[model samples]
Target: MLLEVKNLNTYYGESHVLQDMALSVDEGELVALLGRNGMGKSTALKSIMGLVKPKSGTVRFKDKDIAGYPPYKVARAGIGYVPEERRIFPNLPVLDNLAIGIKGGKIDAGNPDAWTVDRVFKHFPALKARSGQKGSHLSGGEQQMLAIGRSLMGNPELIMVDEPTEGLAPFLVMEVRDMLKDINKVGVSILFVEHNLKVAMSLAHRLYLMGKACLAFTGTVEELDAQPEIRAKYLEV
Candidate 1:
């Protein structure tokens, strides 16, 4: 497994956010974590990335236990995280934003398949064209693209993206979906958190459904298609 979480429990102040949550992603697999808002999907990713300190759980990445490590440690261990908010430096140009994510100030010498600015631009041509534009000047889709591109510059083996196509137009949503597919095709594993069922069903190799802070279903896309009741109960609102 590239990533694993077992018996995970997390809290926010006094509020219980996750309970016995568990999931795994294999090498090079694109796994979708699906749920309505506040169902612990984002929390699960945060816990895995060490952005949230889980009260008790095992976040095992590459077979090493990394449950309580800090966020930087997690990133250096080859896990990239593109957060839900699309947090980019508002004043920084597109190229500069990408530059900030270069892991360890340079790609790991041990891993030659690392990404660079030119490589990132190749993947996101829109960003290349707007390299001189400040982050705040781009459209929503462009900002989302920059976020993913920036994460790629970190040379992570596995990338976790939250809400990649949340509020984009239909065309832009399709573009983002295809972009993710291409990213996966080039030997990067992806853990995606998405609300769009159409997008998830089309791209995911496997699916996990969350409800009330616990896993409700886990299977392939084909299996998910057969469980309309599960979808209606937890996903369709």
Candidate 2:
């Protein structure tokens, strides 16, 4: 497994947000997390990323325990996180934002596979043209692409994204969805939270549904399709 989280329990100022939550992601797998709003879907990702320290739980990546290690440490441990808000460096130009992801300034200048700024541009051509544009000046979809590109610069083995397509035009939604599919195709494992059932079913190899801070269901696309009641009860509002 590239990542394993077990018996995860987290709280937000005395409000219990996650209880015994468990999930896993293997190398190169695309995993989707589905749940309605306020069901702690974001909390689970935050806990794993060390953005919100869990009261008690396990967050293991690459066979090492990373629970409560802090966000920078988690990123250094081969996990990149893109929060729901798409926190880009609003004042920085797109190129500068991508530069920060070069962890410890250790990226080999000659490695082709390394996530150099040019590599990010090659993969996201739209961003290449906007290299000099500040993040705040970009369109919503452009911002999302920059955010993902910035994360990729870290050369992480896995990425945990929250609400990859929260607020955007329908066309942009499909574009971002396809972008994520292409990113996964390049061997970066993904665990993303999404409310769109169709998107989840289309992108994920497996699904995990959450409700009231607890895991309500886990299955493959075919299994989830066969069990419609699970969605009707836990997913449909």
Candidate 3:
């Protein structure tokens, strides 16, 4: 497994947010974490990336235990995270924003590639066209694209994305989804937390439903698609 999270528990002050959450991802796979709002899906991603310190559990990446490491250490260990809010440097130019996120390392060019600025530009041409523009000047979709592109510059083996498709037009959502598919095609494993079932089903090979701060069910996308009752019980508003 490229990423393995086991029996993870996290808290925010007095509230327990993630309870015994566990999941795994292999190389080149796109896995979805699904649930309604306030189910700890984003917390799980934060815990893995070391933004939220877990009370207990193991987070193993590439066979190294990184349970309580800092966020910078996690990034250095080859994990890239795109938070739910598209957090880009608003004052910085597009190219500078991407350049700041770059971490120097050996990139695999032959297969399962690592991203360069050129490759990132190819994936998001709008960013290329607006390389000189400030991040605050871009559209919502463009900011989202820049967010993903910034993460890619780190050359991570795994990317954990939270709510990549939220608050976008249908056309922009489709474009971002396709961009994620293209990135996954090159063998980078993805752990995505998403509320959009249609997008999750279309993109993920495996599905994990979260509820009450724990994983309720996990299986292939086909299995999840067949369980309408599960959807209505846990996912429907």
Candidate 4:
């Protein structure tokens, strides 16, 4: 497995947000973490990224145990995170936003098909036009593209994205979906936290549905489609 998270337990102050969560992504795979609001989807991503420290768990990446490591350490471990909030620097230009994501100028040999600013521009041509524009000037879709592009600049073996297509037009959502497909084609494994079932159904090679602080279902997209009850019980609002 490229990334394996086993028996993950996390909390927010006193609330038990994640309970023994476990999932895995093989190299070059695009796996979707599906769930409704407030059901530990983002929390699971944070726990893996070391943004929210887990009380106990084993996060193994490329045969190495990385649990409890700091955020920088986790990033250095070939994991890049794109938060749901799209936390780009407002005053910085689009190029600068992408520039900061380069890990010590480049990634190691883990990601053979690495990303550079020019490569990012190819994936997101809109960004090239806005390269000199400040972050605050871009539209929501443009900002989202920038966010994904920035994370790609790190050249991580696995990239975890939170709510990537949330709050966007249908056309823009489809655009992002194609963008993700292109990224996955280059051998970067993906663990995506998505609320949009239709979107996830279209892209993911495998699906993991989370509910009530635990994994509710794990299967392929066809398997998920075959189980309407599972969708009604855990996925449908």
Candidate 5:
């Protein structure tokens, strides 16, 4: 497995946000975490990335315990994260945004497939045109692309994205989905939180549904289709 979480629990002050959460993403796999709002879907990704420290459990990445490690440490272990908000510097140009994500020695010069700013621009042609544009000046979809591109600048083995398609136009949604698929094709494992069932079903090799602070179900897309009750109760609006 590229990443694994077992019995993870996290708290936000007085309230428990995640309870006994467990999930894993194998190499070259695209795993989706599905759920409605307030069920710890985003929190799960945050915990694994060490953005929010887990109160307990084990997070093993590439066969080493990473739970409770600082966010930078988790990132140094070759994991990247793109928040739902797409937190790019509004005043910074696209190239500068991409440049800051570089982790000194992370990019292996010997690896032909390793990521670089030009590679990112090639993957996101729209971003290429806007390479000199300020982040706030780009459209929502472009910002999302920038966020993903910035993470790629880290040359991570796996990436965790939160609510990637929320509030996007249908075309933009498809664009984001295609970008993710292309990234996966290049051998980056992905663990993404998405509320859109159609996107999850169409994109993932496996799915984990969160409900009431824990994982309620996990299976293939066909298996999810086989259990409509689980979908209606946990996924449907």
Candidate 6:
């Protein structure tokens, strides 16, 4: 496994948000963490990124235990996170925002080729055109692209993206989905947290359904489509 998370738990003060969450991702695979709102999916991603400290559990990346490491340390462990909020620096130019997140280090021998600004721009040509434009001026789709581009500048081996399609137009959502597929084709393992079932089914090789702070289902897309009871019980609004 490129990334293995075992028995992970996290809390926000008095509230326990994640309970024994476990998942794994291998090189070149795109896995979906699917759930409705407020079901600990984003918290699981945060715990992996070290934005929210896990109370207990093991986060192993490339055979090294990285649980409880700080955010920068987690980033250094070859994990990159694109948050659902699209945390772009509004005053900064698009190119500069990406430049800010770039880190220099030796590339992992087993991972895909590292990402460069030019390479990321190729994946997102709209960002290329807006390179000199301020982030505050871009549309929601463009800002989301910049967010992903910035994370790629770090050259992470595993990427955890939260809600890449949220609030995007249907066309732009499809575009982002394709972009993620292209990224995976280049061998970066992906752990995607998304609420859009259609997008999730289209992009993910496997699906993990989360509920009440625990994993409720794990299966292929075809298997999930066949389980109407699972959908009605956990996914239907």
Residue-level lDDT tens digits of model 1 in 151-205: 9999889999999999999999999999999999998999999999999999999
lDDT score, candidate 5: 0.92
Q: Where's the lowest-lDDT run of ten residues in candidate 1?
A: 103-112
Error of model 4, residue 46, in angstroms:
0.5
- Report backbone clashes per prediction: 0, 0, 0, 0, 0, 0
Task: Tell me the whole-model lDDT of each prediction, alpha carbons only.
Answer: 0.93, 0.90, 0.90, 0.92, 0.92, 0.89
Scanning candidate 4 in windows of ten residues, the lowest lDDT window is: 105-114
- Tell me which of candidates 1 and 6 scores higher on TM-score: 1
In model 1, the runs with Cα more than 4 Å from the true position are 109-111
Model 3 per-residue lDDT at 117: 79
What TM-score, over all chains together, does every model reach? Answer: 0.97, 0.96, 0.95, 0.96, 0.97, 0.95
Cα deviation at 176, candidate 4, in Å, is 0.4
lDDT (Cα, tens digit) per residue for candidate 3, span 24-76: 99889999999989999999989999998999999999999999999999999
Q: How much is 68 displaced in model 3, in angstroms?
A: 0.3
The positional error of residue 122 in candidate 3, measured at the CA in angstroms, is: 0.7
Candidate 6, residue 41: CA error in Å? 0.6
Off by over 4 Å in 2: none
lDDT of 2 at 39: 94
Regions of candidate 3 where Cα sits further than 4 Å from its true position: 104-113
Q: In candidate 1, how many Å is residue 116 off?
A: 0.8
Clashes (candidate 1): 0
TM-score of 5: 0.97
Ranking by TM-score: 1, 5, 2, 4, 3, 6
Per-residue lDDT over 1-237 for candidate 6, one digit per residue giving the tens place of the 0 to 100 score: 999999998989988889999999988889999987899999999999988899999999999999999999999888999999989999999978888778754333454576777889999998898889999999989998888888888888888999999999999999999999998898788999988999999999999999899999999999999998998788854
